[model samples]
Target: MAEMVGIAFAFSYIGDAFHGSQIQPEVRTVQKDLQIAFHKAKFAGSNPLLRFSSRTDAGVTARMNVAVCVVKKSVWQKMGDLRFRRALNDHLKDVVVWAAEETSEDWNPRMASRRVYRFRLETMRQFNKPHDEGKLLEMMKLFEGTHDFTGYCRPEEGRITTRTVDYCKPWSIDGRLVGFEIAAQSFLWNQVRRIAWAMSEVALGTSSIEVIQEALGKGEQPPFFGLGPSKWLTLWAIEYEDISFTDKSGDFFENLSAPPVGINGRQFEIWQQSADHEQKQLLLNSWLSYL
Candidate 1:
């Protein structure tokens, strides 16, 4: 039996173009693109065992995500990390492979130390205002400890809804209710968005804090507050202990950064500029309704 090498890469993707991170038949996804790239590179057998640290839904962007794959040692040494990244990028569109490193075969991205997510809510509407910072902070605190998050997530058959949330809090950025940041080891499906929806209702005075408490205390699902729009949410970061990623040039990254080594950094800058321009135009269009 030939020895295998574990290859891990840090990647980012603009979610608008992808159906989701997971693979589905006849659907475009991050995983599907990556698998195709692997096949093209001849790095793995017909069916590669590619694994991702987090599964993002449609329209949910990610600043940093980790993926791990195992390939024959001979193949890795021959192609090298940098060349491998370049080959992968050649086949990817919205996804960028920024850094790579060697890892143990037993490593699993899902067992991450911490996972942080950000949910942004515009303050233009009454529902987005925080009625009382102190009171809202208190409500956010209720989610800090271990609790059955049955109310905050969609029910999955034979899956436990109980999970520990290390931190959950609302923060304002430049006087706007930017959104809430939540960190946990793992989360239930739609958990963060649903929590944000319930919190927004409380802030808007449409729902009471006691109602949230009742759901938390009773471990029961609350009436649908409505899942926040996926576009406003992002998987901000995933943390692992003592693992570092480096580019093919042997340049080590102190932290997970954007525009990975094989990618054209200027392209991302231009994309952001175009996105900002479009956003401003949309805001102006909305204002025209008032006139």
Candidate 2:
């Protein structure tokens, strides 16, 4: 037995391709697929445990997510980091492992320094109500700093609903409102999505900014803001305090083709479904290039 070594790999995937990042029975997931690829590539040791840095929901894309896998030390040293990445990528589909490096055996992926998320309102049909950049910015600033996000998240039992948002701002491109970005050391479930719903409502005149203000105000009762669709959300990055991963994604992005095309209206419903998926890929690739 060649001792075991832990290697952390940074990867990205189209959210719609799998049920979610965690492993689940029957349905496919990012973790499950990665495990299968590891088996195929012989990258894992006996009963290896793989863990992800962040858990993203179904239909939510990730530009970068970290996961640690335990592999035989000799195998790792012989194959090296870049080759290890290729081994995984060669056996995976949709999910791309772009970077990898050796890390401490007990490395905890969840203890990240900061996690950044982005929600693209323009890509969501429900937020079609007219909105302007100025209004979006104004609505976004209210979320900055510490606030009780009770009304802005789907609370987990026994977990405190109060959380501090490091920063919140409108993410724009070419002078157009793309969506919003928010960062924190950690977040409650659906916190960013709920916040996006509130900001869009206020900017589009569906609700007043005061609704959000009241939600954050201490000792004040908050109202529930609707949850935004997961499809428009993306886990942009996860920063660590002590670990750094080298870029091993040479030509990976360059080799990616443009978004898939959708058929025109022969079967209106099918065409619309195809078009929706196409739009998501387009937006996802756009953000990927920006990274």
Candidate 3:
């Protein structure tokens, strides 16, 4: 049997068009697109098996995600890292391959050191009232330490619910967009969204801090607080030790560092442009209605 070689790569996706990161039969997904690109590039055989660091749900964008796959040694020698990225990008539309490197066969994305996810909340629309920053901060503190988040996540059989949260905090962006950042080694299904839901309730005065405390004490699912919309959430970054990646675009440092203003600042600028255009069109339509 021919020896197998491993390759690791990082990619980003808009996620609006994907059902999820995992491949599902009869549905479009990031994994499906990636597999097709691998085949088109001839980097892997027909049965290319790719493993991802994290599985993001529908409508959740990722700024940086990691994936690893093992292929025949001959294929790796032919394609190399640069050519593989270039060929993969040609077959992808919304997904872009930013970095690629060779790795040992035993290396996989599951060994990632840490993962960060950011949830953006439109407080003005969701709360319909002024937010209390102090109270929100108090709620955020509850999520920092080790806790059984069974109540804050969808239950899965044979899975442990107790997880350590390295950091969980809420901050304001431009005074309207509320951003919640969560960092951990891993997360349960729907964990971040549910935590955002509970915190929003506290900020809006619909629920008190004691409610979250009680849920933690019980270590069971809390009373229904609607899950935050998936569209506003993004997988911000994944971290790993002993691995250095060279950007395919040759702008590694510029892209890796957070901009001087911040990530939300850049996102808000894009959002505001679309919002302003829609507002102007609506005003024009209203004027035409009178005529």
Candidate 4:
């Protein structure tokens, strides 16, 4: 019997196309789709041959999520990373396997060095509340460094809510405040979404900084700011030690020109929706270009 090897790959998907990242019975999911694609590609291994670096909720797109699949060493040696990626993508639907590399047989994608998330604040305009840029950036900085994020996250049994945020800052595109970016070694479920909501509230003057301070002060009773919309959230990046995938997706960063201005009312709402779709398509196209 040939020994089994692991191949790690970076992929992107339109979250709207699936129920979520994890597998669920009687419903479509990223993992379920990957499993089917793997089978179609003739990759032989265990029933669940893949391990994901992170999990995302429904309607949450991912620019770069990683997974490792176990396959016969002989097959991998013959196919190579490029062919392996192409084969799986050939069977994938709405999922682009952009980059891949051979990995240790025991490699675990969950043990990542860092994870990054982005929350599109422009989506908040739908509420007719334009945020104060300075206030938004200020509130985001408060989450930096280590703290008990119990108030900013939905707690799960047997899970510690305390976590470290490496950095949190405003993410601008073409001089326009489009969103915020946050990075951490790991995060509690819904942590980023909750933080986004809190910052949005403070920036809009609907809530005060005191509320955020109280929430981060480790109080017995913490304040709640609600969850942000998942559709505008994306798992932007993940990093791992000793293994790296090249950014074969050509530079689309500079190509994202500043959005148009001077539009308002129902027409502006339509533009917002169209703008989001445009961004998603640009990302998808970039990844596909590597194939």
- Clash counts for all predictions: 1, 0, 1, 0
Which portions of model 2 show Cα errors greater than 4 Å? 219-224, 246-291
Off by over 4 Å in 4: 45-48, 126-128, 219-224, 250-265
- Candidate 4 is scored at a TM of 0.92
- The residue pairs that clash in candidate 2, if any, are none
Q: Against the true structure, whose lDDT is highest?
A: 4
Candidate 3 stretches greater than 4 Å from native: 1-3, 73-78, 171-177, 244-291
Q: Ten residues in a row with the worst lDDT in model 4?
A: 246-255
Q: Return the clash pairs for model 3, or none.
A: 151-221
Candidate 4: which pairs clash?
none
lDDT of each: 0.72, 0.74, 0.74, 0.80
TM-score-wise, the better of 1 and 2 is 2
Error of 1 at 107 (Å): 2.2
- Among the numbered candidates, top TM-score falls to 4
Winner on lDDT between 2 and 4 is 4
Report the lDDT of model 2 for residue 194.
Answer: 82
TM-score of each: 0.79, 0.84, 0.80, 0.92
lDDT of each residue in 1-291, candidate 1, tens digit only: 988888888777667678989999998999999998888866687779899999999878776788999988787888776787787887776777767778877678887888888775442133323365555667788888899998888888999999999998875544544567889999999998888778777777777788889989899877655797776677877778857542221111112122222324565456445543443344334322222
Q: How accurate is candidate 4 locally (lDDT)?
A: 0.80
Alpha carbon RMSD to native, model 2: 5.1
Winner by TM-score between candidate 4 and candidate 1: 4
**Candidate 2 residue-wise lDDT, 53-106, digit = tens:** 998889888878999987777888988867887887888877878777788778
